[model samples]
Target: MAENGFQGALTYIYDPAILLRLTSFQAEYKNGVTPLNPGETLKLRPLCLEDYDKGYLQLLSQLTSVGDVTREQFEDRFNKMKACDDTYYVTVIEDTTSKQVIGSATLVKEQKFIHRSTARARVEDVVVNDSYRGKQLGKVLVDVLVSLGRELGCYKVSLECKDHNVKFYTIFGFEAGKGQNYMQIRFFD
Candidate 1:
Protein backbone atom coordinates (compact mmCIF):
# COMPACT_ATOMS: atom_id res chain seq x y z
CA MET A 1 0.00 0.00 0.00
CA ALA A 2 1.41 3.37 -1.08
CA GLU A 3 0.51 6.64 0.59
CA ASN A 4 -0.55 9.63 -1.50
CA GLY A 5 1.67 12.68 -1.68
CA PHE A 6 0.56 16.32 -1.65
CA GLN A 7 -1.20 15.91 -4.98
CA GLY A 8 -3.05 12.79 -3.89
CA ALA A 9 -0.86 10.45 -5.87
CA LEU A 10 1.70 7.91 -4.87
CA THR A 11 5.34 8.51 -5.73
CA TYR A 12 7.06 5.39 -6.82
CA ILE A 13 10.76 5.22 -7.58
CA TYR A 14 11.73 2.84 -10.35
CA ASP A 15 14.61 0.39 -10.05
CA PRO A 16 17.86 1.72 -11.50
CA ALA A 17 18.79 -1.70 -12.82
CA ILE A 18 15.52 -2.04 -14.71
CA LEU A 19 15.90 1.45 -16.15
CA LEU A 20 19.45 0.69 -17.25
CA ARG A 21 18.35 -2.52 -18.93
CA LEU A 22 15.58 -0.69 -20.79
CA THR A 23 18.02 1.99 -21.93
CA SER A 24 20.40 -0.66 -23.19
CA PHE A 25 17.55 -2.34 -25.10
CA GLN A 26 16.55 0.95 -26.69
CA ALA A 27 20.14 1.53 -27.81
CA GLU A 28 20.20 -1.85 -29.47
CA TYR A 29 16.94 -1.14 -31.27
CA LYS A 30 18.21 2.19 -32.54
CA ASN A 31 21.37 0.66 -33.92
CA GLY A 32 19.44 -1.84 -36.02
CA VAL A 33 17.28 0.83 -37.66
CA THR A 34 18.27 1.91 -41.17
CA PRO A 35 18.04 5.30 -42.80
CA LEU A 36 15.28 5.75 -45.37
CA ASN A 37 15.91 7.24 -48.79
CA PRO A 38 13.51 7.89 -51.59
CA GLY A 39 16.27 8.12 -54.14
CA GLU A 40 19.80 6.85 -54.43
CA THR A 41 21.38 10.18 -53.58
CA LEU A 42 19.70 11.42 -50.37
CA LYS A 43 19.01 9.44 -47.21
CA LEU A 44 16.45 9.98 -44.45
CA ARG A 45 16.68 9.08 -40.78
CA PRO A 46 14.79 9.83 -37.62
CA LEU A 47 15.84 12.92 -35.73
CA CYS A 48 18.53 12.22 -33.14
CA LEU A 49 20.33 14.32 -30.55
CA GLU A 50 23.44 14.65 -32.71
CA ASP A 51 21.32 16.39 -35.37
CA TYR A 52 20.74 19.44 -33.16
CA ASP A 53 22.86 21.80 -35.27
CA LYS A 54 21.91 20.64 -38.76
CA GLY A 55 18.29 20.27 -37.68
CA TYR A 56 18.33 23.91 -36.67
CA LEU A 57 19.57 24.79 -40.12
CA GLN A 58 16.76 22.86 -41.77
CA LEU A 59 14.23 24.56 -39.47
CA LEU A 60 15.60 28.03 -40.23
CA SER A 61 15.08 27.45 -43.90
CA GLN A 62 11.32 27.38 -43.29
CA LEU A 63 10.81 29.34 -40.09
CA THR A 64 13.13 32.30 -40.63
CA SER A 65 10.18 34.44 -41.74
CA VAL A 66 8.11 33.59 -38.70
CA GLY A 67 10.64 34.32 -35.97
CA ASP A 68 14.00 33.37 -34.57
CA VAL A 69 14.67 30.60 -32.05
CA THR A 70 17.41 30.83 -29.48
CA ARG A 71 19.73 27.92 -28.88
CA GLU A 72 18.37 27.41 -25.36
CA GLN A 73 14.80 27.35 -26.60
CA PHE A 74 15.77 24.88 -29.30
CA GLU A 75 17.55 22.63 -26.84
CA ASP A 76 14.58 22.69 -24.48
CA ARG A 77 12.32 21.52 -27.28
CA PHE A 78 14.85 18.88 -28.31
CA ASN A 79 14.92 17.53 -24.78
CA LYS A 80 11.15 17.18 -24.79
CA MET A 81 11.34 15.43 -28.18
CA LYS A 82 13.79 12.93 -26.80
CA ALA A 83 11.18 11.87 -24.28
CA CYS A 84 8.31 11.77 -26.80
CA ASP A 85 9.69 9.82 -29.74
CA ASP A 86 6.82 7.36 -29.51
CA THR A 87 4.34 10.05 -30.57
CA TYR A 88 6.57 12.30 -32.66
CA TYR A 89 8.16 10.81 -35.74
CA VAL A 90 10.37 13.52 -37.23
CA THR A 91 12.59 12.51 -40.15
CA VAL A 92 15.42 14.37 -41.83
CA ILE A 93 16.81 13.94 -45.33
CA GLU A 94 20.54 14.06 -45.66
CA ASP A 95 23.01 14.63 -48.49
CA THR A 96 24.81 11.32 -48.79
CA THR A 97 28.24 12.68 -49.54
CA SER A 98 28.29 15.87 -47.49
CA LYS A 99 26.15 14.35 -44.70
CA GLN A 100 23.99 17.44 -44.44
CA VAL A 101 20.39 17.37 -43.27
CA ILE A 102 18.81 19.14 -46.23
CA GLY A 103 15.13 18.45 -45.62
CA SER A 104 12.84 17.60 -42.71
CA ALA A 105 9.29 16.54 -41.93
CA THR A 106 7.33 15.46 -38.88
CA LEU A 107 4.61 12.84 -38.64
CA VAL A 108 2.90 12.93 -35.25
CA LYS A 109 0.39 10.32 -34.27
CA GLU A 110 -2.54 11.40 -32.14
CA GLN A 111 -4.14 8.58 -30.24
CA LYS A 112 -7.85 9.18 -29.84
CA PHE A 113 -10.84 7.54 -28.23
CA ILE A 114 -12.92 7.84 -31.39
CA HIS A 115 -13.04 5.37 -34.30
CA ARG A 116 -12.42 2.45 -32.01
CA SER A 117 -9.21 3.90 -30.61
CA THR A 118 -7.68 4.56 -34.01
CA ALA A 119 -4.79 7.00 -34.26
CA ARG A 120 -4.66 10.07 -36.53
CA ALA A 121 -1.41 11.09 -38.14
CA ARG A 122 -0.68 14.78 -38.62
CA VAL A 123 2.18 15.63 -40.97
CA GLU A 124 3.81 18.91 -40.04
CA ASP A 125 6.83 21.11 -40.71
CA VAL A 126 7.65 19.74 -44.14
CA VAL A 127 10.52 21.81 -45.39
CA VAL A 128 13.25 21.30 -47.98
CA ASN A 129 16.32 23.50 -48.10
CA ASP A 130 16.05 26.21 -50.74
CA SER A 131 19.06 24.80 -52.58
CA TYR A 132 17.48 21.34 -52.67
CA ARG A 133 14.01 22.20 -53.98
CA GLY A 134 12.56 21.34 -57.44
CA LYS A 135 13.84 17.77 -57.23
CA GLN A 136 10.60 16.20 -55.90
CA LEU A 137 12.16 15.84 -52.46
CA GLY A 138 9.01 17.06 -50.78
CA LYS A 139 7.07 14.36 -52.54
CA VAL A 140 9.52 11.80 -51.29
CA LEU A 141 9.22 13.05 -47.72
CA VAL A 142 5.43 13.01 -47.82
CA ASP A 143 5.32 9.58 -49.38
CA VAL A 144 7.58 8.19 -46.70
CA LEU A 145 5.47 9.74 -43.96
CA VAL A 146 2.29 8.32 -45.43
CA SER A 147 3.86 4.92 -45.47
CA LEU A 148 4.87 5.38 -41.87
CA GLY A 149 1.29 6.29 -41.00
CA ARG A 150 0.09 3.02 -42.44
CA GLU A 151 2.77 1.18 -40.58
CA LEU A 152 1.63 2.79 -37.35
CA GLY A 153 -1.97 1.75 -38.01
CA CYS A 154 -3.29 5.25 -38.24
CA TYR A 155 -6.86 5.65 -39.43
CA LYS A 156 -5.98 8.62 -41.64
CA VAL A 157 -3.27 11.19 -42.20
CA SER A 158 -3.79 14.92 -42.76
CA LEU A 159 -1.84 18.12 -43.27
CA GLU A 160 -2.49 21.84 -43.78
CA CYS A 161 -0.69 23.73 -46.51
CA LYS A 162 -0.88 27.11 -48.20
CA ASP A 163 -3.52 27.66 -50.88
CA HIS A 164 -0.90 27.91 -53.60
CA ASN A 165 0.49 24.53 -52.54
CA VAL A 166 -2.92 22.88 -52.53
CA LYS A 167 -2.28 21.44 -55.96
CA PHE A 168 1.12 20.27 -54.85
CA TYR A 169 -0.23 18.26 -51.93
CA THR A 170 -3.16 17.04 -54.00
CA ILE A 171 -0.76 14.85 -55.89
CA PHE A 172 -0.20 13.04 -52.59
CA GLY A 173 -3.97 12.33 -52.26
CA PHE A 174 -4.56 15.13 -49.77
CA GLU A 175 -7.74 17.06 -50.53
CA ALA A 176 -7.96 20.73 -49.68
CA GLY A 177 -10.55 21.56 -47.01
CA LYS A 178 -11.78 18.08 -46.36
CA GLY A 179 -15.11 19.38 -45.02
CA GLN A 180 -13.28 21.12 -42.17
CA ASN A 181 -11.19 24.24 -42.13
CA TYR A 182 -8.06 24.34 -40.02
CA MET A 183 -8.57 26.35 -36.86
CA GLN A 184 -5.94 27.31 -34.36
CA ILE A 185 -5.57 29.42 -31.21
CA ARG A 186 -2.00 30.63 -30.98
CA PHE A 187 -0.71 31.91 -27.66
CA PHE A 188 2.74 32.73 -28.93
CA ASP A 189 3.92 36.27 -29.59
Candidate 2:
Protein backbone atom coordinates (compact mmCIF):
# COMPACT_ATOMS: atom_id res chain seq x y z
CA MET A 1 0.00 0.00 0.00
CA ALA A 2 1.11 3.52 -0.69
CA GLU A 3 1.69 6.07 2.08
CA ASN A 4 -1.83 7.40 1.61
CA GLY A 5 -3.28 3.89 2.19
CA PHE A 6 -4.80 4.08 -1.26
CA GLN A 7 -3.52 1.05 -3.12
CA GLY A 8 -1.45 2.10 -6.12
CA ALA A 9 -2.89 5.58 -5.88
CA LEU A 10 0.41 7.19 -6.70
CA THR A 11 0.75 5.29 -9.96
CA TYR A 12 -2.87 6.08 -10.78
CA ILE A 13 -2.26 9.80 -10.35
CA TYR A 14 1.04 9.77 -12.24
CA ASP A 15 3.80 7.38 -13.05
CA PRO A 16 6.40 7.99 -10.40
CA ALA A 17 9.09 7.12 -12.91
CA ILE A 18 7.70 9.28 -15.69
CA LEU A 19 11.02 10.96 -16.29
CA LEU A 20 12.63 7.70 -17.28
CA ARG A 21 10.05 7.29 -20.03
CA LEU A 22 10.29 10.80 -21.44
CA THR A 23 12.43 11.31 -24.56
CA SER A 24 12.19 15.10 -24.62
CA PHE A 25 14.79 15.39 -21.90
CA GLN A 26 17.36 14.32 -24.44
CA ALA A 27 16.82 17.45 -26.53
CA GLU A 28 15.80 19.77 -23.70
CA TYR A 29 18.95 19.13 -21.75
CA LYS A 30 21.21 19.30 -24.79
CA ASN A 31 23.73 22.14 -25.12
CA GLY A 32 23.22 23.00 -21.42
CA VAL A 33 19.76 24.37 -21.97
CA THR A 34 18.94 23.66 -18.31
CA PRO A 35 22.04 22.00 -17.03
CA LEU A 36 22.51 21.50 -13.32
CA ASN A 37 25.49 22.58 -11.31
CA PRO A 38 28.32 20.13 -10.71
CA GLY A 39 27.36 17.34 -8.31
CA GLU A 40 23.72 18.39 -8.26
CA THR A 41 21.28 15.49 -8.59
CA LEU A 42 17.75 16.52 -9.54
CA LYS A 43 14.70 14.63 -10.78
CA LEU A 44 11.60 16.09 -12.39
CA ARG A 45 8.30 14.30 -11.86
CA PRO A 46 4.71 14.72 -10.71
CA LEU A 47 3.74 15.88 -7.24
CA CYS A 48 3.02 13.22 -4.63
CA LEU A 49 1.81 13.07 -1.02
CA GLU A 50 5.33 12.53 0.30
CA ASP A 51 6.20 16.00 -0.97
CA TYR A 52 4.39 17.61 1.97
CA ASP A 53 7.36 16.85 4.19
CA LYS A 54 9.91 17.51 1.46
CA GLY A 55 9.67 21.32 1.49
CA TYR A 56 7.00 21.63 -1.17
CA LEU A 57 5.24 24.46 0.66
CA GLN A 58 8.57 26.02 1.56
CA LEU A 59 9.48 26.17 -2.11
CA LEU A 60 6.22 27.97 -2.83
CA SER A 61 6.89 30.45 -0.04
CA GLN A 62 9.86 31.67 -2.05
CA LEU A 63 7.39 32.74 -4.72
CA THR A 64 4.52 34.10 -2.60
CA SER A 65 2.82 33.98 0.77
CA VAL A 66 1.93 30.41 1.75
CA GLY A 67 -0.05 30.63 4.95
CA ASP A 68 -0.27 28.10 7.78
CA VAL A 69 -1.19 25.12 5.67
CA THR A 70 -1.28 21.96 7.78
CA ARG A 71 -0.53 18.45 6.61
CA GLU A 72 -4.18 17.46 6.64
CA GLN A 73 -5.12 20.56 4.69
CA PHE A 74 -2.42 19.89 2.16
CA GLU A 75 -3.39 16.24 1.78
CA ASP A 76 -7.03 17.20 1.36
CA ARG A 77 -6.19 19.54 -1.46
CA PHE A 78 -3.82 17.05 -3.06
CA ASN A 79 -6.43 14.33 -2.95
CA LYS A 80 -9.00 16.60 -4.50
CA MET A 81 -6.66 17.49 -7.33
CA LYS A 82 -5.72 13.86 -7.78
CA ALA A 83 -9.35 12.92 -7.97
CA CYS A 84 -9.76 15.19 -10.95
CA ASP A 85 -7.81 13.07 -13.39
CA ASP A 86 -6.72 14.49 -16.74
CA THR A 87 -7.32 17.96 -15.35
CA TYR A 88 -4.45 18.81 -13.00
CA TYR A 89 -0.85 18.24 -13.94
CA VAL A 90 1.27 19.53 -11.06
CA THR A 91 4.90 18.86 -11.95
CA VAL A 92 7.79 19.25 -9.54
CA ILE A 93 11.53 19.12 -9.60
CA GLU A 94 13.17 17.52 -6.60
CA ASP A 95 16.77 17.53 -5.51
CA THR A 96 17.38 13.84 -4.91
CA THR A 97 20.36 14.53 -2.70
CA SER A 98 18.40 16.79 -0.37
CA LYS A 99 14.94 15.31 -0.93
CA GLN A 100 13.50 18.80 -1.34
CA VAL A 101 11.04 20.07 -3.91
CA ILE A 102 12.93 22.90 -5.55
CA GLY A 103 10.52 23.86 -8.28
CA SER A 104 6.94 23.34 -9.43
CA ALA A 105 4.43 24.33 -12.13
CA THR A 106 0.83 23.40 -12.82
CA LEU A 107 -0.97 22.82 -16.12
CA VAL A 108 -4.74 22.85 -15.87
CA LYS A 109 -6.75 21.59 -18.82
CA GLU A 110 -10.21 23.01 -19.27
CA GLN A 111 -12.77 21.32 -21.51
CA LYS A 112 -14.67 23.66 -23.76
CA PHE A 113 -17.66 23.63 -26.05
CA ILE A 114 -16.24 25.80 -28.79
CA HIS A 115 -13.66 25.00 -31.49
CA ARG A 116 -15.10 21.57 -31.96
CA SER A 117 -14.88 20.80 -28.25
CA THR A 118 -11.14 21.25 -28.05
CA ALA A 119 -9.56 21.94 -24.68
CA ARG A 120 -7.44 24.83 -23.47
CA ALA A 121 -4.76 24.81 -20.81
CA ARG A 122 -3.74 27.34 -18.20
CA VAL A 123 -0.28 27.41 -16.67
CA GLU A 124 -0.22 28.45 -13.02
CA ASP A 125 1.86 28.70 -9.85
CA VAL A 126 5.23 28.53 -11.56
CA VAL A 127 8.05 28.96 -9.07
CA VAL A 128 11.60 27.96 -8.28
CA ASN A 129 13.40 28.06 -4.98
CA ASP A 130 15.32 31.28 -4.36
CA SER A 131 18.53 29.40 -3.66
CA TYR A 132 18.15 27.46 -6.92
CA ARG A 133 17.74 30.46 -9.22
CA GLY A 134 20.09 31.05 -12.21
CA LYS A 135 20.48 27.30 -12.68
CA GLN A 136 17.86 27.38 -15.45
CA LEU A 137 15.33 25.37 -13.41
CA GLY A 138 12.59 27.88 -14.25
CA LYS A 139 13.21 27.42 -17.94
CA VAL A 140 12.99 23.67 -17.59
CA LEU A 141 9.73 23.86 -15.67
CA VAL A 142 8.09 26.14 -18.23
CA ASP A 143 9.35 24.13 -21.15
CA VAL A 144 8.10 20.86 -19.71
CA LEU A 145 4.62 22.19 -18.97
CA VAL A 146 4.31 23.93 -22.31
CA SER A 147 5.29 20.76 -24.12
CA LEU A 148 2.90 18.82 -21.92
CA GLY A 149 0.10 21.12 -22.98
CA ARG A 150 0.89 20.40 -26.60
CA GLU A 151 1.11 16.67 -25.94
CA LEU A 152 -2.26 16.79 -24.20
CA GLY A 153 -3.79 18.36 -27.28
CA CYS A 154 -4.71 21.69 -25.72
CA TYR A 155 -5.70 24.30 -28.28
CA LYS A 156 -3.63 26.84 -26.42
CA VAL A 157 -1.74 27.24 -23.18
CA SER A 158 -1.80 30.55 -21.33
CA LEU A 159 -0.31 32.08 -18.21
CA GLU A 160 -0.04 35.44 -16.45
CA CYS A 161 3.27 36.87 -15.35
CA LYS A 162 4.48 40.18 -14.03
CA ASP A 163 5.73 42.74 -16.53
CA HIS A 164 9.35 42.18 -15.62
CA ASN A 165 8.98 38.44 -16.24
CA VAL A 166 7.35 38.85 -19.63
CA LYS A 167 10.68 38.67 -21.41
CA PHE A 168 11.53 35.37 -19.77
CA TYR A 169 8.30 33.78 -20.99
CA THR A 170 8.79 35.09 -24.51
CA ILE A 171 11.68 32.69 -24.84
CA PHE A 172 9.11 29.90 -24.67
CA GLY A 173 7.04 31.60 -27.43
CA PHE A 174 4.52 33.25 -25.08
CA GLU A 175 3.36 36.62 -26.33
CA ALA A 176 1.21 39.40 -24.94
CA GLY A 177 -2.22 39.46 -26.53
CA LYS A 178 -2.78 42.68 -28.46
CA GLY A 179 -5.73 44.78 -27.27
CA GLN A 180 -6.44 42.17 -24.61
CA ASN A 181 -6.47 42.85 -20.90
CA TYR A 182 -6.12 40.58 -17.87
CA MET A 183 -8.61 41.60 -15.20
CA GLN A 184 -9.37 39.97 -11.91
CA ILE A 185 -11.59 40.79 -8.90
CA ARG A 186 -10.01 39.62 -5.72
CA PHE A 187 -12.20 38.18 -3.00
CA PHE A 188 -9.53 38.26 -0.33
CA ASP A 189 -6.21 39.82 0.42
Candidate 3:
Protein backbone atom coordinates (compact mmCIF):
# COMPACT_ATOMS: atom_id res chain seq x y z
CA MET A 1 0.00 0.00 0.00
CA ALA A 2 1.41 3.38 -1.05
CA GLU A 3 0.47 6.62 0.80
CA ASN A 4 1.65 10.18 1.19
CA GLY A 5 1.91 11.32 4.78
CA PHE A 6 0.31 14.64 4.00
CA GLN A 7 -0.01 17.59 6.37
CA GLY A 8 -2.54 15.50 8.26
CA ALA A 9 -3.06 11.79 8.86
CA LEU A 10 -4.07 9.05 6.37
CA THR A 11 -4.45 5.33 6.94
CA TYR A 12 -5.06 2.76 4.22
CA ILE A 13 -4.28 -0.73 2.96
CA TYR A 14 -4.25 -2.44 -0.46
CA ASP A 15 -6.90 -5.03 -1.18
CA PRO A 16 -9.21 -4.77 -4.21
CA ALA A 17 -11.22 -7.86 -3.38
CA ILE A 18 -12.71 -6.44 -0.16
CA LEU A 19 -13.53 -3.03 -1.58
CA LEU A 20 -15.55 -4.56 -4.44
CA ARG A 21 -17.69 -6.40 -1.94
CA LEU A 22 -18.74 -3.37 0.13
CA THR A 23 -22.22 -3.14 -1.38
CA SER A 24 -22.88 -6.79 -0.67
CA PHE A 25 -22.72 -6.27 3.09
CA GLN A 26 -25.68 -3.94 3.05
CA ALA A 27 -27.85 -3.17 6.08
CA GLU A 28 -31.07 -1.54 4.79
CA TYR A 29 -30.59 2.16 5.65
CA LYS A 30 -33.88 4.02 6.00
CA ASN A 31 -35.00 7.46 4.84
CA GLY A 32 -38.36 9.25 4.63
CA VAL A 33 -39.87 9.58 1.17
CA THR A 34 -43.27 11.16 0.68
CA PRO A 35 -45.52 8.80 -1.28
CA LEU A 36 -42.66 6.36 -1.48
CA ASN A 37 -41.96 4.80 -4.83
CA PRO A 38 -43.61 1.41 -5.00
CA GLY A 39 -40.97 -1.24 -4.18
CA GLU A 40 -38.33 1.49 -3.97
CA THR A 41 -38.80 3.13 -0.60
CA LEU A 42 -35.21 4.01 0.18
CA LYS A 43 -34.01 7.55 0.84
CA LEU A 44 -30.67 9.39 1.39
CA ARG A 45 -29.27 10.84 4.59
CA PRO A 46 -25.99 11.46 6.42
CA LEU A 47 -24.13 8.37 7.51
CA CYS A 48 -23.18 7.93 11.17
CA LEU A 49 -20.70 5.79 12.97
CA GLU A 50 -23.39 3.22 13.61
CA ASP A 51 -23.67 2.62 9.88
CA TYR A 52 -20.02 1.50 9.91
CA ASP A 53 -18.91 -1.93 10.94
CA LYS A 54 -16.42 -4.62 10.10
CA GLY A 55 -17.34 -4.53 6.42
CA TYR A 56 -16.86 -0.77 6.10
CA LEU A 57 -13.62 -1.05 7.97
CA GLN A 58 -12.60 -3.91 5.74
CA LEU A 59 -13.22 -2.00 2.51
CA LEU A 60 -11.94 1.32 3.83
CA SER A 61 -8.74 -0.33 4.86
CA GLN A 62 -8.14 -1.18 1.22
CA LEU A 63 -8.79 2.34 -0.05
CA THR A 64 -5.22 3.27 0.92
CA SER A 65 -3.68 0.52 -1.14
CA VAL A 66 -2.36 3.00 -3.69
CA GLY A 67 -1.58 5.64 -1.08
CA ASP A 68 -4.63 7.83 -0.63
CA VAL A 69 -6.19 9.00 2.64
CA THR A 70 -5.04 6.79 5.45
CA ARG A 71 -7.54 5.84 8.18
CA GLU A 72 -5.85 7.98 10.84
CA GLN A 73 -5.58 10.77 8.33
CA PHE A 74 -9.28 10.51 7.59
CA GLU A 75 -10.05 10.63 11.28
CA ASP A 76 -7.89 13.72 11.66
CA ARG A 77 -9.56 15.24 8.65
CA PHE A 78 -13.01 14.38 9.99
CA ASN A 79 -12.14 15.93 13.32
CA LYS A 80 -10.88 19.07 11.65
CA MET A 81 -14.12 19.24 9.69
CA LYS A 82 -16.24 18.86 12.78
CA ALA A 83 -14.14 21.34 14.70
CA CYS A 84 -14.36 23.87 11.89
CA ASP A 85 -18.13 23.82 11.65
CA ASP A 86 -21.00 21.87 13.09
CA THR A 87 -22.57 22.21 9.67
CA TYR A 88 -19.75 20.17 8.18
CA TYR A 89 -21.88 17.55 6.49
CA VAL A 90 -21.40 13.87 5.78
CA THR A 91 -24.42 12.32 4.12
CA VAL A 92 -25.48 8.91 2.88
CA ILE A 93 -28.31 7.49 0.83
CA GLU A 94 -30.10 4.55 2.33
CA ASP A 95 -32.88 2.18 1.32
CA THR A 96 -35.49 2.56 4.04
CA THR A 97 -37.01 -0.80 3.26
CA SER A 98 -33.79 -2.79 3.39
CA LYS A 99 -32.03 -0.34 5.71
CA GLN A 100 -28.93 -0.54 3.53
CA VAL A 101 -26.73 2.45 2.86
CA ILE A 102 -26.48 2.89 -0.91
CA GLY A 103 -24.27 5.96 -1.15
CA SER A 104 -22.24 8.47 0.89
CA ALA A 105 -20.95 12.03 0.36
CA THR A 106 -19.41 14.86 2.36
CA LEU A 107 -19.01 18.65 2.49
CA VAL A 108 -16.24 20.45 4.33
CA LYS A 109 -15.54 24.11 4.97
CA GLU A 110 -12.36 25.26 3.27
CA GLN A 111 -10.44 28.50 3.52
CA LYS A 112 -9.86 29.80 0.01
CA PHE A 113 -7.53 32.58 1.15
CA ILE A 114 -6.39 34.27 4.32
CA HIS A 115 -8.64 37.26 3.56
CA ARG A 116 -11.81 35.29 3.00
CA SER A 117 -14.60 35.66 5.55
CA THR A 118 -16.43 32.37 5.33
CA ALA A 119 -14.69 29.22 4.22
CA ARG A 120 -15.78 27.52 1.04
CA ALA A 121 -16.85 23.89 0.86
CA ARG A 122 -15.07 20.89 -0.60
CA VAL A 123 -17.16 17.85 -1.40
CA GLU A 124 -15.61 14.42 -1.10
CA ASP A 125 -16.16 10.72 -0.47
CA VAL A 126 -19.04 10.39 -2.91
CA VAL A 127 -19.68 6.70 -3.45
CA VAL A 128 -22.85 4.76 -4.27
CA ASN A 129 -23.60 1.14 -3.64
CA ASP A 130 -22.47 -0.89 -6.66
CA SER A 131 -25.82 -2.70 -6.70
CA TYR A 132 -27.60 0.65 -7.06
CA ARG A 133 -25.17 2.28 -9.50
CA GLY A 134 -27.45 3.17 -12.45
CA LYS A 135 -30.19 4.83 -10.41
CA GLN A 136 -28.58 8.29 -10.42
CA LEU A 137 -28.64 8.19 -6.66
CA GLY A 138 -25.16 9.67 -6.43
CA LYS A 139 -26.37 12.61 -8.47
CA VAL A 140 -29.27 13.18 -6.13
CA LEU A 141 -27.12 12.86 -3.06
CA VAL A 142 -24.58 15.40 -4.39
CA ASP A 143 -27.30 17.76 -5.60
CA VAL A 144 -28.73 18.09 -2.14
CA LEU A 145 -25.31 18.47 -0.58
CA VAL A 146 -24.34 21.14 -3.10
CA SER A 147 -27.51 23.03 -2.37
CA LEU A 148 -26.72 22.81 1.29
CA GLY A 149 -23.29 24.32 0.64
CA ARG A 150 -24.87 27.22 -1.21
CA GLU A 151 -27.30 27.81 1.60
CA LEU A 152 -24.39 27.89 4.01
CA GLY A 153 -22.89 30.85 2.13
CA CYS A 154 -20.17 28.96 0.37
CA TYR A 155 -18.78 31.17 -2.39
CA LYS A 156 -17.10 28.18 -3.97
CA VAL A 157 -17.85 24.47 -3.88
CA SER A 158 -15.22 22.05 -5.08
CA LEU A 159 -14.72 18.31 -5.25
CA GLU A 160 -12.10 15.98 -6.70
CA CYS A 161 -12.88 12.81 -8.60
CA LYS A 162 -10.92 10.35 -10.66
CA ASP A 163 -10.40 11.25 -14.33
CA HIS A 164 -12.47 8.25 -15.31
CA ASN A 165 -15.24 9.63 -13.09
CA VAL A 166 -15.20 13.10 -14.64
CA LYS A 167 -18.41 12.26 -16.46
CA PHE A 168 -20.20 11.69 -13.19
CA TYR A 169 -19.30 15.10 -11.75
CA THR A 170 -19.98 16.93 -15.00
CA ILE A 171 -23.70 16.17 -14.73
CA PHE A 172 -23.86 18.46 -11.67
CA GLY A 173 -22.38 21.46 -13.52
CA PHE A 174 -18.85 21.12 -12.12
CA GLU A 175 -16.29 22.46 -14.55
CA ALA A 176 -13.57 20.05 -15.56
CA GLY A 177 -10.05 21.21 -14.93
CA LYS A 178 -7.56 20.65 -17.73
CA GLY A 179 -4.06 20.04 -16.37
CA GLN A 180 -1.74 17.50 -14.86
CA ASN A 181 -3.73 15.49 -12.28
CA TYR A 182 -6.19 18.34 -11.91
CA MET A 183 -8.76 17.98 -9.13
CA GLN A 184 -6.67 16.15 -6.57
CA ILE A 185 -5.87 13.34 -8.97
CA ARG A 186 -2.72 12.57 -7.02
CA PHE A 187 -4.43 13.00 -3.66
CA PHE A 188 -6.36 9.77 -3.87
CA ASP A 189 -5.44 8.04 -7.10
Best by lDDT: 2
By lDDT rank, best first, the candidates go 2, 1, 3
Could you give candidate 3's per-residue lDDT for residues 1-189 as a string of tens digits?
A: 223211122212111122222221111223522211212566444444344431343333333342354567656655665565445677655566666666666776675565366768888777666677656566666666666666666787788777687876776667765663542236543
Query: What TM-score, over all chains together, does every model reach?
Result: 0.71, 0.84, 0.59
So what's the TM-score on candidate 2? 0.84
Count backbone overlaps in model 2. 0
lDDT of 1 by residue, 78-166 (tens): 67865664577777676767667788788888998998998999999888888887666777677667767776778999998788988
lDDT of 2 at 81: 85
Runs in model 2 with CA error above 4 Å? 1-13, 16-40
Pairs of residues clashing in candidate 2: none
Q: What is the C-alpha local distance difference test score of candidate 3?
A: 0.53
| Every model: Cα RMSD to truth | 11.7, 4.5, 12.5
Among these predicted structures, which one has the highest TM-score? 2
- Candidate 1 wrongly placed segments (more than 4 Å): 1-35, 39-41, 64-73
